[model samples]
Target: MKLNKILVYVIMILVLITSCKKDIVAGEVQDTEKKIECEEVEETPKEIVIDIDDIYNSVDIDIGYVELENLNEDNVPEIDLEYYPKDGDFILKKVSDGYICVSLEEYEDENALEDYLSPMVYRFNENGKLSWKKHYDYKTHVGKIGQVLTFDDDSFIFHIDSYQDWNEGRLINDNCYLIKCNKDGEEEWTKEYSNSNRDMLANILLSDSEEILIIGEWKAKDGKEYDDIDKGLKEELNNDIVITKLDAEGNMIEQKSFGGSNDEHVDIVGYDKKLGIIIEAISFSNDGPFAVDIIDKWNNDFIACIDEKNLEIKWIYRLVGGKYTTNNRFSINNGMVYMIVTQNNRNRQHSQSLITIDDKGNASKLITQTYDQMVDKFNSLMILQNGDIVIGEGNQYISSLRIFDDTGKVKKVIHDINLVPDEIIPTDDGGFIVKSRRQIKTVPQPIYVSCIWYDTELVMMKYDSNYNIEWRKTYDRYKNNPYWDCVIPLNNGKQITEIKTDYRKSCID
Candidate 1:
């Protein structure tokens, strides 16, 4: 009986062990299946490589050329005038064939004591050659072209500040003019806009719905009439910011003005659907027209967002503590305003700061770099879609391009470049293009005379997202003859510039 009981216990223990072994094998199988499934689902993605040659070869950039020597002089009003290259702004717009440019020149009659403004428009072909040149009839009035906007059909309109009348035998620019022209350089219509005081055009912007927004300054006339023209008249005057909305047909729909007891000048403007009109300006007054209070009594640089519908000042952010501030450039991204400004300290030292202003009128300086005495005049600011900020700064002494993250941490910098960027434009392919100029040579004439000539070439550079230079092209065909100001890119991967020869200077006797 004892042997039989021992046999039964042994049999029970063997059965339990067999059941445990079967459960362990099943758990191992399930674990293996999960591991295989995870390995199949978590595959790594392939890296993308961008070919620089592909972008350059995409467009035929060397097809057409505009001969600067052969200017279209047809329909130009004849005058025995001495043309001088004026230091002004140049507006370039790309069309289907090429580009159109409008520039201003100051000319004087032999006997006249003062200089008058002449507006010149030029057209270039596909590869970028001058197709036609048009000179407006400025015999009756002195004026300068402020901005140009093109339509879908290649027709365009430009803003102009023209002399309203001969006030006491002096030509005063007291009115703003909107002149529309066809594709072939024919004037379609001319409209005049003026106020009780002198009006000057600052900029022109188009809304999303194709409406025109004309920004200018309206200054109270000093009420004193003069007999001679003053070249530096605007320096002594103060003006209020004026915004005039017009239909596509150059018809004024609404007009408004904003200012305080002192001077306010608008330098840059941007439009956003949610944020309304963004304005970068320099203000001198502490009250009136400002949505926020100004603490500093000196010249303060500010950023303001205005409601476009009713022309109300939404919010104004003044950059305090600086004695004098000057805004160079600004860009809007992700509901934030980023700009580059130069300010003066108590020791008379100049410093450049990259400032960010939020939508709620809050301002912060992201980075600041001080200059001893000479501040850089050529500066550009742009924010990429990926939250990277690109800033270009250069003087005659040095130049550089820097890329920083959203937190103002430096990512990459192309320092001590030979070219000075006149403008920096973002590309569609996550890169940027720089329109710049390089001083090729400098020739000092006879020591007895203060005659120095500089030979410069217009440079166009394309950079990749990693800040690697993809391609660079220099336009050195004009040498020391043509004086060009700006360069603009076209949709077809080309660039166009208007070359004006300053007839007033000659190194050779």
Candidate 2:
């Protein structure tokens, strides 16, 4: 036949060249498995570079809180400074071979007040030198040194505030001292408390069986005790809201008072081994003159829950808003209780509300968040250890730091242009430590005459678990106001702030 039809066309061209070499080896094995899954997603590791440049050390000492102990057995970190001295009458004594600043010799006549303000305690030594000091003179005429509770057997507690001139200078009154030192700073017991009207203190909590919960703002020794509350309320405001529980040897055991008629204050006191004492207040249903010229008409925001064995009042959540609320900020994890709520209109803050409350108090309102066009101002609120909910907003030129997730949503916002946060601290590697300041304010013109002038600086930022900004520091100290910086974070990663520049140069001289 023609040689069997040319061998059947060469066996159909060898089966079409083996199906084009199996489709080019299946597209080069699917592009080599997508290049080994993109090199394992670029070797995954998101960010953490911390080298804060030896954490800025500056100490002329006027600070009021900064603690990080190891005291000298030398595992490093030994900064504990809480100073006070603008012009001295000295008393810094601690001797086992290291501190002795005693210099009191200027009490010459006419009431002897050559600027002697007292309450000091320094102990630095990680190269900032000076390893011991202690001073506390009650020759008061005004003093404050609140919050400094450290102990794991190093013992310490001082939440002071003294004022003096009781009924003699016709009344000046102020007292809320707690003082309990020892780690060689000496003094063991001081607990004061006072009342005859006008008390101040504001917040302190320590419990885990060590108990100390304070909270303040009470003022009534004259408004006729509102004839014993609730008759239909409106007894014309007198402040009120005090809680006191002490004992770890500061002894006061139990004391309570909460108001209802008009002004109530107490803005935070937490504790939760299952939600026992949580009080956060701001009540005022009418303090007359149409609640001070109608700007939201009157306040009302409560959240109570006391009863860690008879402190009474188990649950109360009231929120009745109308717009003007104020800087409230809170946090408590696992058992709930978040609360943020800012909302304002008498000039600024435009909206914010987080609200969570649980452990039986119920209340929910997880996220309201609004800031109209920016004048934002609620500064601090943290709750992270993984439940994540950090928030801190500011004004006069940027300062943000949002981060929310746990269903509250927002998840990360940072910002920080002129800096102003007041405190944030949350780390263990999930990074965050903000404490900002930087104010500027200069008005001085005839533009509606109000006379303003400030300058302050004092920021300290350090973030990383991906919110990256591994370091930032500022410290001009003060020029017109704010000076209460406190940073403390060490275990070798370095950080210890609170340089209170002599109370901002004694408030600009």
Q: Candidate 1's residue-wise lDDT over 312-353, tens digit each?
A: 888977666662344345788877888776766778568877
lDDT of 1 at 432: 79
Q: What lDDT does model 1 reach?
A: 0.64
lDDT of each: 0.64, 0.57
Candidate 2 C-alpha lDDT tens digits along 1-509:
34234434544544455565666876797689887774433345334332212111121212222221212223322344345344433333323333333322222346664443456666544444566665675544555554666655656676555556544447656555667877766888986666342255667777667787776666542233433555455444477676778787787887766664456676667788678778766666355211322224334556777876567777777665554335555778877888776655555436777778887888777678666534555667878778888877775355677888878888778774455566777777777767665543332233224323334556566676777766665555433445434344542334654443454223211
* Residue 63 lDDT, candidate 1, scale 0-100: 16
List the lowest-lDDT window of 10 residues for candidate 1.
75-84
List runs of model 1 lying over 4 Å from the truth: 1-91, 96-98, 101-141, 152-154, 163-176, 181-189, 194-198, 220-238, 291-299, 323-327, 343-351, 369-378, 394-398, 440-453, 480-487, 497-509
Top lDDT: which candidate number? Answer: 1
Which one wins on TM-score? 1
